[model samples]
Target: MEARTGREKQVYKKGSIRQVAGCVPVNKTTKKILLITRRKKKGGWMLPKGGWENDESEQEAAIRETYEEAGARGKVTSLIGVWDHNVINKKTGLPKATFSFFEMEVEKLEEKWPEMDERDRQWFAYEDALKVLIKPFMREVVEKCSLAPSNKRSKKEFSESNINKNLKDTWNLKFSAIVVFFAFLIWYLIKDNKFISILT
Candidate 1:
């Protein structure tokens, strides 16, 4: 998965405020992500997300939406990030709606769930999930958090760890190449020495 800074490129400052919580439910054991499709909408796929009432916390809202939309529940590993986009509210005015995303480790996939008739849920491989997602930022968030859910690390921490690991691997590769080059050089010197070959 690629790394992204998730810039707020389309945030609206005026009109009513809307808050939504979304979850990228993952199963590290199977390395799959849960995606949902609207009953009437075709082709496009999405993570479990919905607006929350004032009484619910962001985390609670996310979990609830996951169950209602995806029919799975588990621990929230991290607050992935927030994305804002400009949209027209009911009053026909522009508003910046915030979508707060989180990574959830799915513990179970129930046989029955709310909105089962209105939504279709399925597990998808990381790559396939990216292709089905309709929103670009949503895909970015998923890719950023697509690290194994068991790691339960924040996106920033995970990215830094990956950077360090990649750097170490690159250094080791370079060192190995140099060692192989020197070994071949020494072998060639001995093999091509006429006097040394005659003595052996």
Candidate 2:
């Protein structure tokens, strides 16, 4: 795999299936969610996840990805679900992709970030984090995290918060865009006919 600025290109063996793992770390006492901030890729706020290595169990792979990406340590508690999605590789036109999901509550939250590559790691309240997660499924998984055996928050609480945050973010983004558009229009009107010609 070649690492570029905010992108990674990985080469896999032909006809080989790839396995990936992720962790959904929820704080038991605070009912907050933990997420790692690595560089964004493909326009998504991705989780700390990666492919399985030689002879590594799926669970071990998941744990390793979590540590490497998030600087947190935990054990796989349960299977949230598996995602088998396909993407056409533009370079090869072959249906190249990965199948991945997460193992929930695999381990307890660590007090200190693990010594690894420098990545910003932080925990957000369930509502706040969902807004930043690029994947809808991630929001869904974190909302469900409170239902895990180790979670302290009630399921209903997380569900409501998740929904509310989704709505809030939607409206906020729309409103911001509208405001920017209007500001640009006013600027154009005040500037001259050249601005109008450019828009047209």
Winning candidate number (lDDT): 1
Superposition error at 116 for model 1 (Å): 0.5
Off by over 4 Å in 2: 1-17, 40-45, 89-95, 103-117, 147-200
Cα lDDT tens digits, model 2, 21-105, are 6777656567666776655423435467777665566677677667666666655667676654356666666555454556445
lDDT of 1: 0.79
Q: Rate the local accuracy (lDDT) of all candidates.
A: 0.79, 0.62
Clashing pairs in 1: none
lDDT of 1 at 57: 84
List the lowest-lDDT window of 10 residues for candidate 1.
Answer: 1-10
Clashes of each: 0, 5
Off-target runs (Cα >4 Å) in candidate 1 are 1-15, 86-94, 148-200
